[model samples]
Target chain A: MEVTASIEKERKTNLWGGGTSPLKASYGKIMMWFFLLSDAFTFSGLLITYGFLRYSYPAFSGPVSAFKPSVDYWPIPEKIFDAVPFLHGVHLPLLFVGIMTFILILSSVTMVLAVEAGQRMDRKDVTKWMLWTIVGGLAFLGCQAWEWSHFITGTEEGMALSNGVIIHGANLQVNEYGPPLFASLFFFITGFHGTHVASGVLLNVIIFYNVVVGTYDKRGHYEMVEKVGLYWHFVDLVWVFVFTFFYLI
Target chain B: MEQVVAVEVKPVDKKKVKKLWKIALILGVVTLIEFVMAFTLPRGYLLYAGFIGLTIVKAFYIVSEFMHLKHEAKALIWSIMLPTIFVIWLIVALLAEGGSILNALY
Candidate 1:
């Protein structure tokens, strides 16, 4: 009776002492959460840096129709990001980015659905949803590539630098946009995000392969899918903020 | 004597699947609203605040429902969220510095 009492006390008091899952989560899952948290910090750092630079610039204040890129002020986002795929010379204004946002959100949904199917140990369902998720990710990446290409290939009438040198498109050194920093930040932030999406698609493919081979079935759990889903959702979450800060604001 | 262990497979829950789609719909509508406001509303502090507020709303749904962070242990949730406070702090501090620099330059 005394030993039983002591065992109960130990269980309550030594929950995190050792050899116990105090958080009621598997070790792998807890580690994944921490990794995500660190990644969140990295992204926040980059975005906050963007905010700082943006604050330092005087915003362009004029009618959109009359707006022109200059070194003196920050260019309006809508005026700059107005092009759409195959709709050359037409001013669409954030339409392509809005579509990219939709694609990322849809991919996030498919990833969560894959996680749900994994909970049920339904391999077929997991495979289907994972494939869809990969496709959505690929689509987003393709859209980003197109957007980058457009930014690199500037408008027909390029902006003249203060030194009187006309630059057509954006490179590391010069751009037709307002401030050269604008193009630099745009490349860094979106390029970083695009890299994440690419890696996420690769991870999804690996997990999908494992699901096909029934590795999880032998292991008797779909926790791997859950881990990768956490990562996939994180990529989507970061894009949500990037969309707001980069495109909307 | 021989013993056999059978893996348990639960039936798919239709309600859960429906809820996931419901969350997706909410996200889609929120993005659409953002796009509408971007063109309709004039650029100013109010517009910026509105955009940020809507963004947080979308983030809550994604993290809580899609990422399943809402159902996790309180300790885990707190651990993740508490560090994000520093990120908020950094934004305020750095933006202030940037504003000062702009004032000095102009």
Candidate 2:
């Protein structure tokens, strides 16, 4: 037993005890993992808070024939987000946001492709993919701006409670939707996520510049591209969760 | 004597491109499925559960393929994933507490 134990100890030491890359991963990348983990906690807090608030309220029932927002219940997601751009009065729920999701995901694909090209030391391919990714990110940002503005300028007429509390469109205090907390959470969560996308765009721009200037080529590897690819993929991942929690649900 | 570098001009990997297109198609199809389900399914826990399940499936594909986490060292993947248990914990705790609060207040 002693001999077997020593051999096992030796093997484990050789694998992990030496001054080497932890799990064969770099410091910065591992740090990125930790950062993503913490960010995940932050998002969890926000989403759980949303769940708590949503649980506190009753959701609307019946078909469109009898639907109306009141203090009695929560507004159904489809009912609230049914407007389409340039087609006023069109009742297409969640369609535009779905398009936004696909765009972000397309950008993620480009990012990974850029990293893959960087792995192959294909400078031109990296540049092309990175540029496409930047465009995707920028397009997503634009769509978000439009969505936010539409949400702010809500189309549905708000119900005025008999207590003389008049709720119009969504402000920080109240909305045409069920409760004030609903719009507040929507703005906070989506705005926080939009900030992430915006920063991601800025990072992509910087990396795109570096790729064009042949910086990674001189360094003999595209670890930076790989790093950014991880972040871009993470942004897509978060959106997947958000889409489900907010839109699809 | 100077060293002469032999630069190999190679084509892009067709297989890699094919793989990327495959992933993109799969994600799109899944989203379409969710869309169909959203409108058709009666509002209840069943619809909610299905949507969350589909979302998780798409998430798995994105993280494993696009992030290349599956190809990374096993230890690395664990380090990143294990912390997610805390998120689950957060969900359970907050949901239960919120429900209790609602019960107590009303």
Q: What is the TM-score of each predicted model, taking all chains together? A: 0.96, 0.92
Candidate 2 structure quality by residue, lDDT tens digits, A36-98: 889888888988888888776655767754777776677788778877789888889889999
Candidate 1's residue-wise lDDT over A37-153, tens digit each? 999999999999999998898877787678999978888888899999999999899999999999999999999999999999888889999999999999999999999998999
Q: How does candidate 2 score on lDDT? A: 0.85
RMSD of 1: 2.5
DockQ of each two-chain model: 0.68, 0.57
Q: DockQ winner among the candidates?
A: 1
Best candidate, lDDT: 1
